[model samples]
Target: MTHSKRYQHRTIISFFTVLIVFILMAGGVQAGIEPSKVICRVETDRAILPAGDSQNVVLKITLDAPPSPAHIKRPLVNLALVLDQSGSMSGTKIQQAKAAAIEAAIEALTRLGLQDIFSVVVYDTNVHTIVPAQRAGNIQSIINTIQQIRAGGSTALFGGVSQGASEIRKKLESDYVHRIILLSDGLANVGPRMPEDLGRLGAALIKENISVTTVGVGTDYNEDLMTRLAQKSDGNTYFVESGFDLPRIFAAELGDVLNVVAKKVKVTITLSDNVEAINIIGREGRIRENQIEFYMNQLYGDQEKYALVEVNIPKSTSGSRIKIAQVDVTYENPFSRKPEKSTGISYASFSSDSGKVARSTNIEVIREYQLNLNALAQEKAIELSDQGKKKE
Candidate 1:
């Protein structure tokens, strides 16, 4: 072969090599990653604080899914997709939802394999189980069943969720990540329609390690009811303004579900005597005395979960340092298939110079703190509006 031809061949090989590398890396915290790697950190928004009493401070506990190479086993997921087929979801809404459900099923089959389980449940005025809970193997069958879902009748939101939860309980196992993805666009007009009824059900399901994620389509759905159920069960919620967003949202949610690295995660932060934990912002938790406890149902391999504790820092002498937090984290490792725990402690320093305290602020932690505070304020605004006190 000629030298020029050989050089050209080598260049072609290098280009293909680079392309393959880029494609693999683009998956980004997704499935087929080493699942046991979780990095825990406890940090104060500012390592140095002004030397004063009852100063506002933020304590952050972060659980990060560490980056890793591909091809590793993750925990099995048992997902029950509860879809709404009400009269209001007759046009683009129903079609988009069906397509999204089919896409999600295909994605789940590709990632979840034979070890994981999936089912389909649809509801209007009456509840129906389209696909029974079973190991994920027949993607075609699930797709066909989902396509048959037609829009008609009023919405029995409570019955739909209750049925999905029942389906998940069929294969309830200690190691499986049990969850229900509820998609609805209308109000609950049937029996047991109140938000409190669904909230009570969510609370009950969580005791058995089941979470319900509520996706509200358009603005017609009761956001309060949806959010309440999700919050009580330690699940995420989403609001989509248009039907076109359903497919993307379902795919993204399924990706996260398949990439779970840790489950049954428990984080407990005990503050020092001199420090008082006021509340947990952005997420739900129990703040009692000096101890703050929260339960994170699942952690995805490509996401970072954190808790912001609004704290009160007591007066300290200048040039003195104080220990503020003792953080303990426990979770079931999906890769190792075993339980593990880790502990970390955070401290803060007092400075007489305001510039020193400003310089010591961790920008990332502070940004998160401010964002969560804004979210808390928005939540309060919504609550006030709902209570017939919008003028306030």
Candidate 2:
């Protein structure tokens, strides 16, 4: 909901007064190195639950930023720039967007790791691959091609993204963090154009570990479609009211690219025997027979990523402890060039004291749960509006 503090990360203080944090200590991480340990925490909405009938509870699994990456070589980035060269971006909008894109690409290319790859795809009524995915060695040629381009056709937003993702898939290796930065100045006029279309495409792309950051340039662009794609793909989305801020947005996106510390992060929450998970709040999560899972393409340094799962908890005897869930996290640590794993379990005790149950309420988790509920309401409203049932 806010971008002002996008880069300002908060320190993680695991479940305060009313919660418990358990770190999963494993046997095989490189010994002696402090950063080798996974900075993950598992907690519940309360340290204690009521000793009566079934209760629905929230389970939170947090992955604190791993250690600072100053000591290790940064990971490779496989990036694609998808530019909308539609008829609407005729004047300053097109000019400024091109200038900003070229500037950002050149700057990133100058210092990219040997394994990093780059590509550029421009789209109008039809999608075109202006620059195929390749190492950053031909700077002048790339600039020349960008400068000679002109804008005049309708927007094929879907095709543009599809082509961009296809290019990145060329070198989709575990060593590289794949991303597509799409900038647009018009609504989709050709091909699949609805926000739902882009959302479905984004969801599919993320399965391959590729994220598409969408930048809506000027007031004419469709914010709904842009944000839908980004949200579905687990990428950042920006709405720039003016073309003047295109360069700034592009640079900020690059900054995030460099801050990546881990990639292909898979977090699985296995519910205990009796607990039944209702759903994952806030973001997309896969629910299995007895497990809930979430995935992250990459994690930034000191950035906190977490998941909230709503579960149906069975009643337990007063003073008895009942297991809730266990967390298992697996990610590729680019610095160590190896896969890593972390695990932890959470248990809640039953209390007959009404006051004790009330006092054990986790404020933070409750706040997150409220936000998730609000998001769900908004989503329902949008769907209703889309169905032409606004009055209902």
- The per-model lDDT (C-alpha) reads 0.73, 0.74
Candidate 2 lDDT, tens digit per residue, 184-208? Answer: 8789989999989999999999999
Instruction: Give candidate 2 misplaced runs (Cα > 4 Å).
Output: 1-34, 91-115, 384-392
**How many Å off is the CA of 68 in candidate 2?**
4.1
| Clashes (N, CA, C under 3 Å) per candidate | 1, 0
Score every model by TM-score: 0.84, 0.82
Model 1's alpha-carbon lDDT is 0.73
Model 1 poorest ten-residue lDDT run: 15-24
The Cα RMSD of model 1 versus the native structure comes to 11.6
**In model 1, what is the error at residue 11, expressed in angstroms?**
47
